[model samples]
Target chain A: MRSDRQNRTPMGLKIAAAAGLAFLHLPLLLIFVYAFTTEDKSYQFPPPGLTLKWFAVTWNRPDVWDALTLSVKVASISTVVALVLGTLCAAAISQTRFFGREAISLLVILPIALPGIITGISLRSAFNLAEIPFSFWTIVLGHATFCVVVVYNNAVARFRRMSGSLIEASMDLGADGFQTFRHVILPNIGTALLAGGMLAFALSFDEVIVTTFTAGQQATLPIWMLEELVRPRQRPVTNVVAMVVVLVTFLPILAAYYLTRDGDQISGQGK
Target chain B: MPHAVTFQQVSRHFGAVRAVDAVDLEIAPGEFFAMLGPSGSGKTTCLRLIAGFEQPTSGHIEIFGETAEGVPPYRRHVNTVFQDYALFPHLNVADNVAYGLMIKGVGRAERAREAEAALEMVKLPGYGGRKPGQLSGGQRQRVALARALVNKPKVLLLDEPLGALDLKLREQMQEELKALQRALGITFVFVTHDQGEALSMADRVAVFNEGRIMQTGTPHEIYRRPQTRFVADFVGSSNVLSPDLTARLGGPRQWASLRPEDIRLDTDGHHRGRVIAASFLGSATRITLEIDGETLSVLLPSGSAVPEPGEEVAFSWSPGDLHVMGDEA
Candidate 1:
């Protein structure tokens, strides 16, 4: 029957899907395997033997500590900045009827849409023209451009989906403007903002290209990892650091996915 | 006494479209008033204006003797039960009901106690912990009621509050709403397009059409003597007789209306017509008759001798039953 055909997966298609998943995830599996490798100088196919010595070495290295701390600091600051800017932009764009509103929305998301090199070039030139020194703040500025887009996309979708009557009901029930927003509007979009903030943190943690232009001499974790890859040294340590990077960036994205999964639906609402 | 709410020459326009035209009206304190009209009739807009969600584009509004011009909804002493309930999705029933008090900075323990009492008021005492989504449509409606009533405002504006329920639930809610209004003694200004709801629930009904009130009166007065042709046809089903039919009924008027129940089918009667259709309603049967090429509806109670289609029937009515319209001095 047609139902039977739909219920069963063909052998060829099942194999193809398995192959695709393996192709995407196999590199991460190799990274984990090499992090425990006994060989310190070369990447032998089977990783020769396994040990935990590189983790101790990574913990003691001051350069790795500096890079890790800087990456965390930049990502956190950028996420905070993005949450405030993106939410305000989303509220203005979604809640009002004004001329050139679409243009404003397009402008908010343009930095993310443009190629990273183009964004880097523009930021570098703008900073140069303004005579601003590149430092931690400049690095944060570079990360926040795309971070704001992620937050804006999530926040605007939620703001647009939320029923306007909820705010009206709050007002009619004797809640002032600030109170209405805190009690009604904030609760409605809280999960969305959290998800957007998490995703932005993940993106900023792994960002490399924009940081390359904006950061003068400061080496973030990704930049340090790139340098380590170019000039090979204690190769197993680099693999161990990659494992940390994967975990650091992957946890927030995973949490963000779960947060936004059920956020699109309004409880007790028809649509 | 000053009215609970008053609109003086109010009008709200969205660009070229007049959502609420120049209007004047007053709602007395503790009165159950209904705005009855079809969609886009500006009844909802008028309710929103009272709620201060929308201000009059051109007139003045007053609440409790004070001119409420430019007053925000939060500053006004009025609450609303929206058609969709508009329950806060993030909070449980207790928190949702307590939102107004929380915004007003009421103590947590006191707010919780008041919320429970308010829930009990609407007959949903133990549903405080459940999410609004987990409850049924009727239960959610009660939660919305509890949320608005927790504040105890001077007037409660309901924008088609029972529109989302089934027929049986809607009927039950209508009775409960009327009882609640009487018990609380608060002004209840509800809007709806269902004439049955307006007639059975509200003390006074204002019929609206094309952004203007066609007539406003008590249910009996509006039903018995609808002033405008729109009020006659929209409020209830009526056989709007032409000027010719009006004259034949011994009425001096340009337009007249006759309720379907007023027409009687008897063997000995003044007028004769052919039965075109017979619809058997549970309590009453609506029989359509064609007299002189003009169709009329005659409603007869059940257990009467029913007329078959294509059968000839004689109908009669008292001259006083003819509601002559368009005879203003």
Candidate 2:
């Protein structure tokens, strides 16, 4: 009888969730519809005509490709750096007793918790103080600072849930330090690491505020879209590019969700 | 056989608490030794110290006659079956059991063969393809044992290996573990808080309290002749009476320990008492009697007629069954 009530609750929740999802996608659907409108100068409620010209125009633009490549490069490099540093920090903090561990953990998470504009301003000022020129590397560094928090949060939670006895058992079975980590700890946390890396990559790909401060003359995809919005002739192309960005970033987020879904249940029971 | 593992005055302190006080013990090769104690009594800590997970604050530990100081768990010729099993979740049964063999760089065919044999020994043949999550609690435990035993170490440490199983399964596994230990002829050092687990499985049991070993002996000896009050009370149900009650019968000790089964109920010429409570436990009826304001519990055979609560009764036992213990020692 109690389980019947539990079943009804999720059914109600599913309907509410479907409504919420429709609200979110309605605006996105309008954007896609307007991308094909022949009346391209202004974003009106209903299109006067429909044509494939905007996609053709978006495809021919070399500038869009340059921006897309730059965004990819920055996101890839930043995600790699975040994965390595974040994993090391998580591993060090998760399994040991030490002074200032809480403080260290807070510091690792603070970049993402703070406002994006604040992070951008601070990075800009710090770069100025160091007398470093703004370039691709500076943009990469800016993205990595915030991306590390995503990976670190996921990896640390994974590490904490992992049973310490597993490591002890591995060691007791005559596996050396590196071997134990390879055979036991790594396998246990593998799904979490993949999920974290994917989330970091998605976050870095779409980030615009910090990228604006860090990239002086170079334009990433988001920054390029901002430039195109301000400029007069490239309006429909901007909508097309925006749709592409959503797809590229959304796929990884979806993949990350699926990867991490089973991890929580497995770790909970394994403990 | 010579001592396979020994702890000489070993102690470990965590902040202000002494988790394992100065303790000395020797485990013979192929012997099934159990460290029995309540939670926080340092039985697990002793197992950890032997497994090289924790360094002693003082004293020395030796494995196979070699000093174990500074030796990490990986270097020690010992393996452990942790209470939660700790089977690798990502790996299937075969790979989990073969982990140790793979670490030693054994050939794939040999490792597979040995892992299968170990699985069969645990009565889980052809379960090699299933992950730990797919198996039941008991199956996971068997996989953990197979993983540990596949390494063929000199000593096997089990820290409450049956602790997570249900009572019936725990009893079944206890016998299987004992038989496996005999067949393998590996020294087994089992740690548990359950007296029945220790009494049924161990060749020798070491009773621990407050980070110190109170007594160590065979199960019969420990049960029949407990040297300390703590051991007598912890290992089995016992009737504790003030020394004044037994002074006329014997010594000057302040307390005397009597096993519940030792007390005989008779109709006359015995210590007269009133029945306070009677609990029928299927095999035996445990009767509590009030004598001179003190309650003494006695376990009588199921067929014995028990008096109603508040009825007069007489309790008597053989003089040899009384174990005198120093006050709270």
Candidate 3:
């Protein structure tokens, strides 16, 4: 009806949207193009020639494999810690009203709200003061500081949207506290936690600022990429690794978006 | 047998607000009891107290002769149909109905069979596979009812279950709920602000106001002989005649209630008034009149003559119809 006509976006707005998307993605397009370029040192327009040799070169590097292993381990461990701690914090804050609840919620999310360098420097100084050596565990702890915040943000929003009556209904239907949490609460928040965990993994995988401070002799993928850029060793190989990093991070983020877009579809809301 | 629920001067307070003030109540077993009131009138709080979602701040509560205080909701033999239905969004209809049985460690196949039976009882036999989101509002309401009833709780607490349905659906559900209660013979403690639902469905209705029960009686007794001004005014539209007007009408100088439908217009009528407005309501015409410095409403049958605005008319009711109300609480 008339709503279809009213919903038609203007040509100007459509052009603006397309231009905005292009502005953000065109640089990433360059990375894809250069990964196949034959040039080994400097970036060039249209790439003098396109070849697939960089992929094989990147695959052969032992250093690349080590960095990839470290990144996956750190991201996986950090995501696990974040999932447990973040869900606990979200459940406590969202389900109950107590003194200083708002302040506590703000403090939980403070690591992400502050500048990345600030979190990095504070974590480094704290570890040094405690006479602790920078190991893979240090990188995981640092990544977890912010990853927990990401998971907390997603979880708290979902918990607040969930109806309190659902819990009451479960309890009234003879479910104990543990049973209610397992059956009613877990299923309701399952997708949100999955999306949150994916986002946390993606964030920790590429996090370079804190990793630079916390990693002693270790090289995560991003730190390795940084070293490759500075030393200029088979430049297209770095681009090829960059292509992997983009895909590894992009798939989870895309999955998170799809998971959360239909978040308000909880059935029987306000019925 | 002991009553299904009993409240001995029970109250629930939150800081300075007494949400459910000290009040006593009793619900006989197998009775369809209704707690009717406007919002914040403590009807829902009372229902929650019975369901064990709420504990009384002071005083004792008993369920089937057992102590109710300090008992968790899961330990109580009661279930509730929440106002919003509260069907599990992640679960399909069959799983939602079988949630209680699942918690009790029922086997998968038996759970599915019982869930199907519960759905069939609610007249939704083949709807077990569909998700709650796919069903309409009324269908979700029935699913909520089925989910609660499948447990076979000693008492079923309903919190405004029909509040969200359209008029026709609400009326239909009300009859179905009444029939279900009668057939199951379980104590039903229903909470609602809709007086019509309470009047039409409950075996006994408790009218609540300001965290206290104004009156409790059979619907016919409540309609014909409201004991207080609040009950008379709230239960249905009635002309609450003050003591001054009662004296003018040759009744004792006491507060009285007169039903609109009880009065008849006739040439030999003694009481006279000027019609201020008249509105047609399909079956009857509601005539507002200015009588002795007070406004009174009278309902005339649709086929009867309606006096025009500003015209004089006389109406009278039988002496027995002029109900003298008791003193306020």
TM-score of each: 0.92, 0.91, 0.91
Worst-scoring 10-residue span by lDDT in model 2 chain B: B245-254
DockQ of each: 0.75, 0.76, 0.78
Strongest candidate by lDDT = 3
Quote the B-chain TM-score, candidate 3: 0.98
lDDT of 1 by residue, A156-224 (tens): 989988887888888887888888888788888888888888888888998889999999999999999
Worst 10 residues of 3 chain A by lDDT: A262-271
Judge candidate 3 at residue A142 and give its lDDT: 96
Query: Which RMSD does model 1 reach against the true structure?
Result: 3.7
Please provide, for model 2 over B163-226, each residue's C-alpha lDDT reduced to its tens digit, 9 standing for 90 to 100: 8999899889998999999999999999999999999999999999999999999999889888
- Top DockQ prediction, candidate number: 3
By DockQ rank, best first, the candidates go: 3, 2, 1
How far in Å is the alpha carbon of A111 misplaced in model 3?
3.2
Off by over 4 Å in 1: A1-4, A38-41, A48-51, A125-133, A263-271, B327-329
Model 2 reaches what TM-score against the true structure? 0.91
> Model 1 over residues B9-66: C-alpha lDDT tens digits?
9999999999999988899999999999999999999999999999899999998898
Q: Which regions of candidate 3 fall more than 4 Å away from where they truly are? A: A1-62, A128-133, A234-237, A263-271, B327-329
Please give the clash total of every predicted structure, in order. Answer: 0, 0, 0
Q: Across residues B1-329, which tens digit of lDDT does each residue of candidate 3 receive?
A: 99999999999997898989988999999999999999999999999999888889999999999999999999999999999999999999999999999999999999999999899899999999999989999999999999999899999999999999999999899999999999999999999998899999999999999999988899999899998888889988788999888889888888999999998988799999889999999999999988878988999998998889999998899979999984441
